[model samples]
Target: MNGIFGYAATAPSPSREEAARVRDVMAARGPDGHGLWSSSDGRCVLAHRRLAILDLSDRALQPMRCRDGRYTIVFNGEIYNYPELRRAAVAAGHVFETTSDTEILLYLFARHGAEMLSHLRGMFAFAIWDDHARSLFLARDPFGIKPLFLADRHGTLRFASQVRALRAGQGIRDERDPAGVIGFMLLGSVPEPFTWYQDISALPAGHCMSVDASGVRQWRYTDLTAILSAAGGRRGDRHAALADARAAIRDSVKAHLLSDVPVGLFLSSGIDSAAVLGIAMEQAKHPIHAITLGFDDFAGTTNDEVPVARRIAEYYGAPHNVRRIDRAEFLEDLRAILTTMDQPSIDGINTWFVAKAARENGLKVALSGIGGDEMLGGYPSFVDVPRWVRRYGRLARLPGLGAGLARLMRTVVPWYIAAHPKAPGLLRHTSTIGGSYLVRRSLRLPDDLADVQDPAVVKAGLARLEIVARMNATLNPMPDTPQAAVSLLELSFYMRNQLLRDADWAGMQHSVEIRTPMIDIDLFTRLAPLIGGLPAGIGKQLLADAPNKVLPDWHRHRPKTGFSIPYAGWMAGIRDLDQRNGKAASSNGLLSRTWSNYVFQQYPAGA
Candidate 1:
């Protein structure tokens, strides 16, 4: 992974020093080399910190311009299919000055312009300045595997791979975005296009924006849900679908392993990680390393992943490393973990530790199983949300009944029921896929936001978030089947906002690149047609039925106890969480809320 930062202005041009300062702040993301380029007229500047994953010479250094010097780019991602793209570009009369993907990308853009995004496959967040057109084009990858944050304020447009780096730019302020703060409180992470800062915004995943003398125009270059819907209703033969899925997954894993540096797998007892591990090992030319994280509190319990992960690693003949965390170690790393977080998230601690372990073991890149659940229906939302919507959706029509039940649930219900969070709001979202998802995924129910956040902020945030309306806007115009609906909701909300963002920050903090083969856009486009119409649980079967049978039954059949830390116990000691509140920090729910608040306090968005 690399870091990219740049600025474009229609008025007073920003100085090179400002872009360099942003680069300095993000140096950890790309320690290999650094460079800066600016237009002669001083209207634009681009800076890059290179990690040297591909084409490891100085010629590959970025902020690169085309052979004709008509186009300049500062890019921060790998183009997994660049070899093929390069071959096509060469055949199409495009000349490349270097073997770098950056050069290939620049050439491709020169030939195809914005149309180039559809021809590429990989994670990317890049800004290309068209010297001739006098326009700046910025795009993020399909699934948001990479990040692109922008601050468009004070007559300047500044962008970076990390939000903090964008904040480092001149003329950007740290004023709190009420919607973003409320989003953090509701979802434990801020949603796209709404960073914690009022002036800063993330470019939504799978979308691109162009800035020129006229104004800013943005559009979705690709839509996963639309792809899924177009491919829905194809309910192919089960055996054929399974075979296709297995083949697609294997091919995606092979593509993801295309880095110059050694890559490893984050092996867990779960089916997702195990499946990825198996595929990666089969494709790797050398012994692949597998890492597992365990907690001392779960040593003798079924919750421990180390033992099962070790067995799977041994079966594959891969070197296995188990990093066990005792309370003492967790306590020691608490400060660093919190500090390294780019945003306030209750999750990502597991990723932080696993990535740290991978770095310690001399691995520069590692693969994770993040998208498996969203892609293959592993989450309960696939089943539960649909069931709830089906059961309670009709009752929602009886005007006051739904609201009355929600009021009762909020005032008198036990915390366990309340902790389900979305239960009360179930009636509201029951009518549509977007609404059902909000109920299923919300950390704090709509009625309960006042308990954690200011009433004014909550009102403003909810209005701005327009949670259901915004979600509905991302949906396919065609109605989605139950399975496809949940998949779309999860991918758009939880997976994009939490999982992918967490993976990026946590992995990069330790200088380890984390790849998710299951998260590939091309793979999803291929498999969506085959499984989009299937019922909730069949997607898992499709993924598990690999032709080689590399996964053992024991590991695959094990109950899905999510990869978790003993955060409740850890927080009790670290924050005195148990005694600070009137209630015990007995459940992950309360502990999560406490920790979320603490993380926010430590890294306040407004600050």
Candidate 2:
């Protein structure tokens, strides 16, 4: 909801002007106010740009200090359970200064230290400056819903809400990270713990770090895969599971409506967004405003979401706003969109325009249904990954046999099978849940990238990224079922690295906060027990029935086309434009793969 930047160093702190420059780089994220706080000893500084969603008073402004003067904090996010946490703090003999979650966080940290993270139920990326301890503590939410990028140089650590902001600070080196560039080529987005710049890295989700005279230390406090694995055997009755899921959805939707300003919903034809709209109408004290993005190219076609979403809004009796865009608008906004992008991504173009429409309509916060698929087995990966593991897992265990067979097929098989890019990977990766999921989700395989990128860069990047190893680690002890394993892979990698990260930068670019009820930790906790136990497709139906009335049969049974735009056709136009102008453009391979290459070429590392 805001932009935060600061630094803690063994040496003197960066100049106040320099820190403010970093904060100002994210001015669009927080247009309401700005502040800077520096320690008297010049060891640390905290700066903030305020969007003023929860409490619109100067009293709520941060870098806020605790009453005891021991702790000062700068935070960027909402703590939905702060009202409950505040009551506990008051009972524990703490006095309050303002009705803001940031104050409650400072008091809780004073009382519980790092243990306070477990008590929180919201999205956040924050840094607390302990003046007395002369140490800095930084933590990101369990889902990485908010971003925190860090750069350490000469024992000085700098943190910001954005990678571009950190680069604008002019303190970190501008050297390109080879792993990061290749990561974008392979995955269409730079994976966490790495960034486009060698000097900057994203803080991994569910993790925290501390910097002091003892040097910096980082650790994980929560792991979603571990939680899901631990709850594997507790498969209760199907009816009871459905009831629990409904209650969790309602509770999460109500909590996400915590903003003081009017809240809105991003309505779509999909079950995920429609379900959210229905629940919000039932729970919100006021009428919920709903917004949907429609493309002129698909206005009369099945791909357009406007008509279906409008009918859903009418059924809920909520105010609806539809924004229709055309190819001309896409061409005009392409430059600004790329510049606003914090990293190279084949995704986020849809999010960018939708968030822009929300802001234009005077909405400061909106709820999205992004995480529903990953949590409820709505993706094809759920079926394909498990089947691959079951059928070809034994072949993978034989190691060289699988590899040798794959090589033989590529060289000697029929042209269609031999020329297929993923055919060899399917044979080689079908052994483990991680490998199978990779085959399902990778934008371009390592072998595919080898045909485009330098072999040395591809080799080094794969080694540093350790893509499959990292994916498998999320399933640490391994889930009890293939379904649960695929869920962990999708949530831990695709959602964490791409969906959630894209939502953050895109929403912030337009100064709108996009909240995801489907992504809540509490909701996931309540439904984790029944992940692999329930019948296929039943989980989504449970969500559809969460509100007072079940969704229409036509709405629930519609084939999943996903919320998307006409990107392929539009990119073809862009390619044509570039070719006519004598500029190089990628014209071969899958649209997503070529789009990934084009995005990197425009926003290459260190640019």
Candidate 3:
């Protein structure tokens, strides 16, 4: 993994020093080396900061040009299947100077053009400067596991692996995007295609863009929901489905282990991390290193993941390291955490510390169990969303009646139920899978966003965001079952927008590359046939049993307590510290809300 930045312009391009300054903004992401390349005509420039994972040789250094120099590329991700792709390139009469995946990527694009995206199998956000065509081709991974932000001003296009990196460059405007501001307020993270700044936007996952004299054009190449929806025709017996799922998990775990450096696992009490650890042990030639994050507050309580994670490591005979963090450490690191954050998010605190632990332990690459909940039926939304759609869906179809009933329930019900924020949206959201999911995952309901944001901004932002409509679009060619629908929603929205984005910024903040085997496109495609066919909850069990060893009964049956930090208690401590220092303390309600407000305050949209 690395930090990549460049510009393509109709006018004289940005200077090498300017490009280098933007690349250096993400210095933490790449500590190995740096390079800069500019077109002879001075219309395009590419710069890269290398972490040097796959090939540790200088030959693999990039802004790497093809043999004939028709293509020059700056890439910021790993391509897991590069070995196989390289063999094919060689067989087709291409020569390779380095064994790096970036070389293979350049060759594949030379041979296949945009079609090369479908052949890739890892996280990436890359820009290829086609010297022959005199255009720039930019593409992001299907899952958006890596980030690419773009800024277009007067036909000069600047792109980077980070939003802040783009902002650090000259000529990019800093005007706040109203939709982005409200999206962050409503979702705790800014949604895709919008950033905190109006002048920059994310390159949507599963899509590619080409910039040339005719201007820019973008088009989607893959859609996960559509893949799942079309998979209904391939259903098989439950036993066969389980077998397929096991094979897919093992294959994915094996593929994600593609690294030259010592790879580690982020083990937790949850089945997802534990399962990945088990499979890694079975497949690894060397004992895998397992890292777990433990909190001082939860050390002895059931919430602590240390003891259980340690036991799992022992069971696998892997090296184990538990890094214990306290409220004091959290407070001390607060400023740095917010500063390193690529954009405002409420979810990266845990990822931030764990990634730090991995880097401190001398690990450059680590595997995580991030997408397990969405891929398997692990989240409560899998059960609750479908149930809500069935029960209140009909009632929600009636416009005024549903809203009236919601108000009536609030007036007459018990205080706890009346005060519950989601209850008010029940009637409005239950009509469809997307609407129900918005209720399940939103940090604040649309009506409640007005409390924190200007009413006019709230109104205009909602109109521009069209959150519900976009969520619904992900369900196009809708899946056969509610379970599949919710899974698609969770994967496309929560995991894609928040979890994956957080992992990118947080992991890169510490110069560590965190890979997710559970989020593999190949694995998802292989198991697509079983997604709507298998009984609920069986997918996770299949994953747990993928390895040869049997997991302890306690782990399999343990309640799904998600990986969490004591943020509420930590924030309260901050408030107390502020009061003692004669400063105004931030008001508290929901911890998520408070943190969201705090992050926004630190990186105010207007600024």
Top-scoring candidate (lDDT): 3
lDDT of 2 by residue, 6-85 (tens): 34334555577777888898988889888888876677878899888988899998889888788989999999898898
> lDDT score, residue 273, model 3?
93
lDDT of 3 at 561: 84
Per-candidate TM vs. native? 0.94, 0.95, 0.95
Ranking by TM-score: 2, 3, 1
User: Candidate 1's residue-wise lDDT over 1-607, tens digit each?
Assistant: 1222233343677678888998877877788889988876668888988877777789888789877788889988788888888888788877777777888778778778899999889999998888777788999999998999887765577888887777777777768888889888878899988988888888988999988777678999998877888787665676677677789999998889887778899998888888888778888887779999989888889889989888888887789999987788877887777766777787998999999999899888899988888888888888887788788888765778888887787678767464566677876557666777777777676677888788998899999988878877777564457777777878887988899999988888787888888989889988887644666666766666552656777766777888888876666645534346414435434566677777777784333
Give the lDDT ranking, best first.
3, 2, 1
lDDT per model vs. reference: 0.79, 0.83, 0.84
**502 Cα displacement, candidate 2 (Å):** 0.8
Query: What's the residue-level lDDT of 205 in candidate 3?
Result: 90
**Model 1, C-alpha of 301: deviation from truth (Å):** 1.2
lDDT of 3 by residue, 1-607 (tens): 1222233343555677778898898888889988888876677888888888998999988789999899999998889888888888888888889989999888889879999999999999998988867788999998899999988877778889888888777787767888899889888888998998889999999899998877889999988888898887778677787888898989999999998889998888999999999999988877789999999888788899988898889988889999989999998888888888888898998999999999999999999999998888889898899888888889987878877887677678846542476787788767888888888888788877877888988998999999988888888888998888888888888898899999999998899999999988899998888875656677778878988896778788787787999865687655423332222222223557667777887873333
Candidate 2 has its poorest 10 consecutive residues by lDDT at 579-588
- How many Å off is the CA of 306 in candidate 1? 0.5
Question: What residue runs in model 2 are displaced by over 4 Å at the alpha carbon?
Answer: 1-10, 413-419, 575-589, 604-606
lDDT score, candidate 3, position 489: 85
Q: For model 2, what is the C-alpha lDDT against the true structure?
A: 0.83
